[model samples]
Target: MEAILRIYTHYFIYYDIEMTQYANEIKISADNPKIGHVHKPNSEATLMGVNVNINSDGLRDKEYPVERGQKYRIIFLGDSITFGWGVEKEDTFETLLEVKLNEIKPTEVLNFGTGNYNSEQEVNLFFKKGQKYKPAHIVLFYFINDAEITPQKSKWEFLSHSRVITFFWSRIQGLMANLSESKSFKSYYSGLYSDDQQGWINTKKALTQMAQYSRANQIRFDVILLPELHNLNDYPLKAEHAKIITFLNENNINGIDLVPFFSSVEDPQELWVAADDAHPNKKAHQMIADFSFDFITRGIKWEKN
Candidate 1:
């Protein structure tokens, strides 16, 4: 009986660990002429043991009808980071920011974040769908990789549905990514990070348009720059951050850089979901919410109409 109980305990622990590492199975529907592809509406999935719900608008939030003048709405735009990848809907920084802001004033945050979205896709999504929400403010969360073009869905994406397979597959992928000198990997990285690349040019144009739209509509636009987890300690992306800051300045867009704060942390890895997965964990989201809360209340001019 003792041996049997010990075996059962081991199995349970293994199962729990496996589930925790399981990546979310995002159900992608038909390609959108505007944003390429979007998650199926009203879909449900679990990522890293956190449940996710995609509302009718293909956003990771509760289904709330857009009724202008009822509450002050702030639209959030970005890729998987703003979408709360590897975390539950409520645990997202946008959701947390909404909750925190509402405690001070009546406000609603509309999250328009989606996985694999670059700056161009995010801007397109806003004009195509998010404008109906009647947002007074727009917060664009800029991740370092937002300048890169979205990659094609892997043939093995379907296999990710199995938690056990995903766990092992992710490990294998991580191992491969670390061997950066491989021919295929070098080309991929070069395309993404090259300074004179078209991807960067496209990103700048989209952001500039977004800024112009905000100015014309009298909507407050603020950009929150997020850092890649691996570089937080070494701070290797200063040049990239500077380029983004220069673009924001030229466009007259308000911006905040979270790199300095994250760099000060003793163990940046503690803020990440996993060593393999660089997405910010729940604690990091809370930090972001707190930081943005202070920035909004103090740095920005937001008055209730």
Candidate 2:
């Protein structure tokens, strides 16, 4: 009897272990580049190093290893939104841009965009690691969302306690268990409640300081401002961009402003953005890619190529 009880207890223990939840990073694959993921060399510190695929994909779980003597490298730097949230790896703007470039030019572009990264960290990434790559063009993708203070409030919590976001998402799943038939309700509630994206004001010079560094090194710099799904003229963010743009101009840094593009969005809901999440889908990425390719290859004259 005693032996049987002990065996049952051990079985329960093993069963519980199998039910454990996994961290978000665990879902990424090091070999597959088509899933459209972003990875960090290390994520414990404030300043993190990220490896994204500019050619294979906009974001990649695997690292984009640079050849020792490869010439003409382009580095894409940005946060999670720039990292392509729910989209697959091969469909990102950076990857599309690289394909377009390959059709016209003959060079490799490396993307280093990571999730939950701010411009301050991006500057660090370029100064610390990008030089090793000897990139010809340093394209920094700055989202209006970066102005928020706590970008990874949920993911950071998941690092310590996966149950935090897990439970919340679970409850949402339960609430929508029966309402799955309704797309609008599913989208609205999912967007509103899943993540606590309360945007907060932070210091604005993060990008300006970055601009100064890239400029001093005589590298071609372009700041692409990725607009959120929300309206462009809205408070907090629109005003936020004003401050960043002013700083860029004050320092004479070239940048792409997308406020005009936001006003032109016809049916905003068509941009479901991966189940009402901030990450836009393939269509949005294509639009951004078209805009970027024209701006980079045509609008700006690069002395490197």
Candidate 3:
């Protein structure tokens, strides 16, 4: 009976720990009017066994003050890919890039990446919150889905603090989205390649504004085009990619396309977080960091004194 009691005690302890961990997963607040959502500042959460922390500025990193003559600040702006979803902060490409750039010169890469952020929201975030940082360079990690408009906040958004509810809700939403044969999904996935949709137009406008802002501030601006995993193999969105490239060329913005490099891989599937998630894994992040390091040091002329 003593052995049975010991086993029960151990099981209870393990169960409690598991519950606590899951409970910490939900750390986002939906009260932001500018962006649909923002990370809860100074909060810690765990997702896919990876720990994430949001600083006082609601960024993914720890508190970092922006000051001139100390370190060159580079702000990375984008969606979940740049946010390092499904990976720890240290495993993120932004952090890796920071480390690599610091080797050449003192630098700080501020991660302003937030999940579910579209180009419009990202641009808004930069103008409202990020501009105060006064970064020397801005890197926008452009994902195809970034063209989509931000979803309106629902009443259920208030329950986002509950990890259990959020997790199950997310799963249900994913399932519904997959099963959806709606025109919106079809237009987004298939029609976007050929048609010049409003989303694409808005995305271009946002990018242009961001570029213009950078030019006005004398900050170097670069766009890193991140491709979807499936699109990498067959290149379903060639037309869309070309349009973006043309836009960048016209705006005189530096665009780094990662599709060719990612597609050149023997197996692009290996770079994904999981079969379902489709977010880039650690290998992909490492490759991006390496490529970006090369681009920053060799491709662009930096006035690093």
- How should the candidates be ordered by lDDT, best one leading? 1, 3, 2
Summarize candidate 3's per-residue lDDT along 121-213 as a digit string, tens digits.
Answer: 888888877988888889898887877766666676446444455446656776887777553343465554344677667778888999988
Clashes of each: 0, 5, 0
Candidate 1 segments exceeding 4 Å error: 1-25, 152-173, 181-193, 299-305
* Cα error, candidate 1, residue 178 (Å): 2.9
Better of 2 and 3 by TM-score: 3
Q: Candidate 1's residue-wise lDDT over 1-305, tens digit each? A: 43553355344433333333223445464365447767677877655556777788887887778777757788999988898877766778998999878876788888888877898889988998888887888989998878786455567766654545544665676678676545343355345656688778888888899989999998888899987777566776777787789878877889988888887777778888766466888999998888878766664545543
Clashing pairs in 1: none
Question: How high a TM-score does candidate 2 get?
Answer: 0.64
Summarize candidate 2's per-residue lDDT along 1-305 as a digit string, tens digits: 43553355334422111122112432232332211233434332111111223333323434566553444568888865566554565777877888788675565667677665666556655665567776777888877545444333234443333434444555577577656755443243233222343322232455666666677777788888877664434423555566667767777878877656667676655564534354566788887888878777755443433
Root-mean-square deviation of Cα positions for candidate 3 versus the true structure, in angstroms: 5.9
Which structure is stronger by lDDT: 2 or 3? Answer: 3
Record all residue pairs in model 3 with backbone atoms less than 3 Å apart, i.e. clashing: none
